[model samples]
Target: MTRPKSTSAHVQPTLAQLRALIAVVDAGGFGEAAAELNVSQSSLSEAVGKLEDLTGRPLLRRSARGTVPTPAGLRAVGHARSAVQAAGDVLLAAQDDSQLSGVLRVSSFRSGATYLLPPVLVAFRQQHPAVTVKLLDGDRAGAGEQLLRSGQADLALIEGVSAVDLSLTPLLMDDYLFIAPESRGTQPVTVQELAESPLLLSPRGDACFQRIETYLGRLGIDTSSATEFEQDSVTLGMVRHGLGITLMPRLALLPVPDGLVLLPLPEPLSRPLAVATLPWRARLPLIQAFTAALVASLGSASGQTTPLALPVWNQSPKLEPEARG
Candidate 1:
């Protein structure tokens, strides 16, 4: 009685298999990988050997201490992670239904996803725990476009006063506040006054800062002296440590992170938050569910009778075809 070969040929590598490979290398032995994977040692060895044979490279070496990947194996791990993530994306996509069972792939910045999305996502999970949610991080201008362009994600939450492509819904209305250390004092700092003082900003080329720049220019101040940070969360962190001040949305406020105050922007400096999606995504049920959850969360947080509505991701109504002059 011969044992049957266990690897699937017709399909791309399954997440379980890739993860098992990763486990074998990370754990340093087939036995440990099996234990971690909750399978028998024999099964783990066969699976890993199958993976090794399939890739045509020696992925692991049995050493005195434990297991580790060869040079080729290390590269394999990186590819395996991406394959596993893509597989996970597929699994999430397949689960799409009223239950939001599929994966809800969302791309946003560090602060936007961490602070702005939790309440909505929390509510969404409660409504449909079976649905897998993947929140990716990207910049306001770039991240949203990445989700739509990569076809890996279905929706995006971009915070800014400007518009992107024609396929975006403008969910406007957020007053970008100048947050600073409590030591900066209780009085609200004017944008000009703050800009002159080594302002900490949320990255260059950020749509949020662009809007702020135009608004500040009206007040006769130039922000060329401003300093920017890559991570949205870090920008806030620097302010907390007395680095400088930054502007962010109201939803980005949660427990205030200590030693910081979300001061109201000077009047008339308020900005809009936009939600963009692929035009075809108008029909995605999971996207719709997340949108509903987002509105509900924002309404509850702001204490407003009407929550901001999700924008139409289809071509923007603001854009019109130009005359062929």
Candidate 2:
């Protein structure tokens, strides 16, 4: 008599399968997820399909709005993220605890990426040449935190991080300033001037721009006529042309562009820039190493010791003195 074939009762999922599921869910479609993962659409679909087969459940819902996680997928996605993060930690654990090596993925907003991270990255590279650092976009408000929660990034340089789950390391207090064409001169901007100026605004989702709008609105200033620019440099360029004035963080206005002047705001305003990471991952050798490099770079840049805590916000810190004249 022929014995009946038996199938295994257990189901197992590979990191690739879990990652494929996550990408599809996050991107809301196979095509976009495939592009993000740098894989063929068909292959990505296949990976998701296999994951579904193993779990015996359909994991995505396709609709006019786009692909989204099914009920089961919604339940599973969080676990999948945790699993992937664990896999990374395993690699981290395997490394010589004294020496750091592996990919360190970081996300940051435009200003931090441009002015803040470069020196830190340079210092980090010099110390740990074996580690590859990847910078991802965190341009929108809360984008950095979202990337961290989704396990897409190891660290995020963010402004005023409010997420309770992540651990924060305060880096700097970046003051907001009134920026104007040189023709406007070295005078501090008055509230009336700020309220009446044709404002060159950053794009809608920018954190700094949103804060400026909120602060102005509280003072009864109307922002409806502001012209939005996609790039900070472009907005500054327009300001230089005498098209409009803007309120910007000092970091974004660095090097005191030759044609513009930085003026103190009528009222003090600042944002706290910090490095964020999952609480558990905060002490990972790689992250700790990066933190040391970051602190060292900040000290070197400021020509002063990097403070352990961020300074109080809205302290009316002196504007760049050289830009006054």
How does each model score on TM-score?
0.57, 0.85
| lDDT (tens digit, per residue) of candidate 2 on 1-325 | 1223225566588899999999998899999999999999999999888788777778888989899988888989988999988988988966775678999999999878898889888777877889999999999989999999888899999888466799998887877888888777776678899888899999877787799999999888988889999988899899999999998987787656777777678888988888899999887889888877777677665555663333222322233433221
Q: What is the C-alpha lDDT of each candidate?
A: 0.66, 0.82
Best by TM-score: 2
Model 2: CA > 4 A from native: 1-10, 23-47, 61-68, 308-325
lDDT of 2 at 78: 85
- Output the number of the lDDT-best candidate: 2
Model 1 Cα shift for residue 63 (angstroms): 34
lDDT of candidate 1 over 1-325, digit per residue (tens): 1234336566455566688887787678887778887889887777767776667667787677888888878888877865765555554456546656656678776556776787777788889888788887666656677556545457777765444441555544754566777677656567566646667766558766777777777877677888887766787788889877777655454435667766666665655565667665544567767776776676666555665532212121111223332
Give the per-residue Cα lDDT of candidate 1 at 205.
80
RMSD of each: 10.8, 5.2
Q: With candidate 1 superimposed using the best TM-score fit, by how many Å does residue 102's alpha carbon deviate from the native? A: 2.3
Model 1: pairs clashing at backbone N, Cα or C within 3 Å: 28-67, 92-103, 95-102, 96-102, 166-316, 173-272
State residue 2's C-alpha deviation in candidate 1, in Å: 46
